[model samples]
Target: MNNPNQFIPTPYTNSVDSGNFTWSAPSNIALVKYWGKREPQIPANPSISFTLNKCKTITTLSFERKRHGGFSFDLLFEGQPKESFKPKILKFFERIESYLPFLTDFHFTIDTRNTFPHSSGIASSASGMAALSMTLMSVERLLNPEMTDDFFYQKASFLARLGSGSACRSIKGNLVVWGEHEDIPQSSDLFGVEFPFEAHEVFQNYRDTILIVEEGQKSVSSTVGHDLMNGNPFSEARFAQARTNLTRLKQILIDGDLKSFVALVESEALSLHAVMLTSNPYYILMKPNTLAIIEKIRKFRSDTNVPICFTLDAGANVHVLYPDEYKGVIKTFIDGVLSLFCEGGKYIEDKIGNGSELLTVNS
Candidate 1:
């Protein structure tokens, strides 16, 4: 499972002319953010994330034998034809075609929908690519009925990473780690692994309330931002810092240290933005409301002695993270205070969830 070549499928034992698969994959919020990446979508640093429950993507992929060659596919977003999405999917197919050799064998119809907005900084790529990868793996399973559950999921994650690096983390549950870290022996740069150690009960069912600061495409796409890190002055130090934070955060999770958790998580979030700002052709993703929400979160935690903290992705939206026990108070605070900073008073309530699910399979 550690070798990339192992994911390449052998000749199929069974063949099907037509089939369809449906899967739902949840988005994840990285506690230790993965900013820059290497080629083929490998993260520059190790990172861990909380798999979110409510914000997800559900996709159905149907395939039929085609007479012509090349990767043929039609994409639909929420039941409407979406031509703009085809280019990304085409690129994904090119990246994964070697692993799944059936790419050109059939014409595919991919129908995808999301619970949240498409490019609103919610890691839609993570959930969307993860769901599509899961569905593709389902088709692989049918072609090779003897595939083990372990191998199936591993390859699914591996393929998802080719599409989006964070998408690999979306393949599994509550806590997942990606990238090679010395402390985590089983951790691989190939795909994300479920956190092996037992996290304290306090970390269980962690709540993440997303305050939507802006809802459209980001000013800087993650791809462009990641590319800027190529010659970034702070890149090496930032990667090293992430590794150290991950090691410390592992202990925090084990010991149920909410205080330390808040510190590390918030630091990682800010560091991610710092790297962006320091990159050549500097840019800022956090909007005014983003900073406003962060200030309010810190002040509220200071005033109420709550463990509440906030984290940001590569976008302006803020994900307010806290333990499940404080939901009632935090909800009140979010509703009364944080919601105002959000666009149209929009926010999504979510919590740590078990990863992706196979919604349906037909052959």
Candidate 2:
């Protein structure tokens, strides 16, 4: 428990004092899907996730210490300046100040880098918010050391959620489930079991392979997706499925059965999007070639009997799940699949990851 990044700086009460901090947060893939939210800040249905072993964003933030105004950001998506995100950036910082109240009135030069391709269906938000959260906490500690851990994660997730829904899960360690989701908080109350569904060791081995079916960004934002879900006739049923999926999948994870887990994961992801399709307008996240990849995977499984399967978020990407032992077989299949895709088909090797660590804290 050494504090490598620990700081012992004199506390400053002024928000205008400029300073900088660097941090990183790993990406995560949902195992038990959360498709909607009561407060976009909090999930409407409980979801469990594995903080990825691969894919994350690193951010170096320098504050304009003497200036006092609403937060200003320099957002670099995939190393390119994208000013269109400026409004969202300003609003996100405002939301943080509104809730935390301690982070208002600062201008920041934010430099962000993603280890994975942002447009290649990788989850950039999970890692991005995580980096944001960690850096903010570091900055907060320098300015105010009296903050509590309870408020730390909740506020982190809440702030990050404005950027993306999956951001909420990045605040915790490897396996984190937002208890705010179900009527039953994921904290406990797993059918009165001695241990909750998310606490098992079997889930530690759970990993995902994100296949970018369509490289372009999604047409439906998560916020928009939730609204669409709300309008769907099956929204209620879909939510119930989320709760049930979490419960059942937790047990399957504990049992460490690859086949059952894959089936459940694939089904849950499909069902989440199916609700989207059932919306009055009936939109689909799947691209034309997305299904071709699925069919390829399905056929590969049929031929090789490899323990592998696919899942999707509201985007045209697929998260393939497999045991650590069969990584070669799954990887080879991916190689073939990518060979058929456009310019970017490369996959990153990822596993469940621990949250942010202070790489360095200047004295």
Top lDDT hit: 1
Candidate 2 C-alpha lDDT tens digits along 1-363: 112112222345634366778777777788778776655355667787777765878888776553464455677665688787677667666655644444555566677888887787677767787677777766776566566765455555555665676776776667676643343343521101112444446456756777666776788777777777667778888878888887787667667777787788889878877888888777788876677777887888889888788878778877777767777777777787644653365556677776655565542
Off by over 4 Å in 2: 1-16, 76-81, 148-151, 181-202, 341-344
State the lDDT of candidate 1 residue by residue for 53-141, as single tens digits.
98999999999988888999999999999999999999999999999998899999999999987755689999999999999998888
State the displacement of the C-alpha of residue 261, model 2, in Å, after optimal TM-score superposition: 0.7
lDDT of each: 0.93, 0.67
* Candidate 1 residue runs with Cα over 4 Å from true position: none
lDDT of 1: 0.93
TM-scores of the candidates are 0.98, 0.84
lDDT of model 2 at position 47: 80
Model 1, position 342: C-alpha lDDT score: 90
So what's the TM-score on candidate 1? 0.98
Highest TM-score scorer: 1
Quantify how close model 2 is to the true structure by its C-alpha RMSD in Å: 5.6
Residue 165 error, candidate 2, Å: 1.9
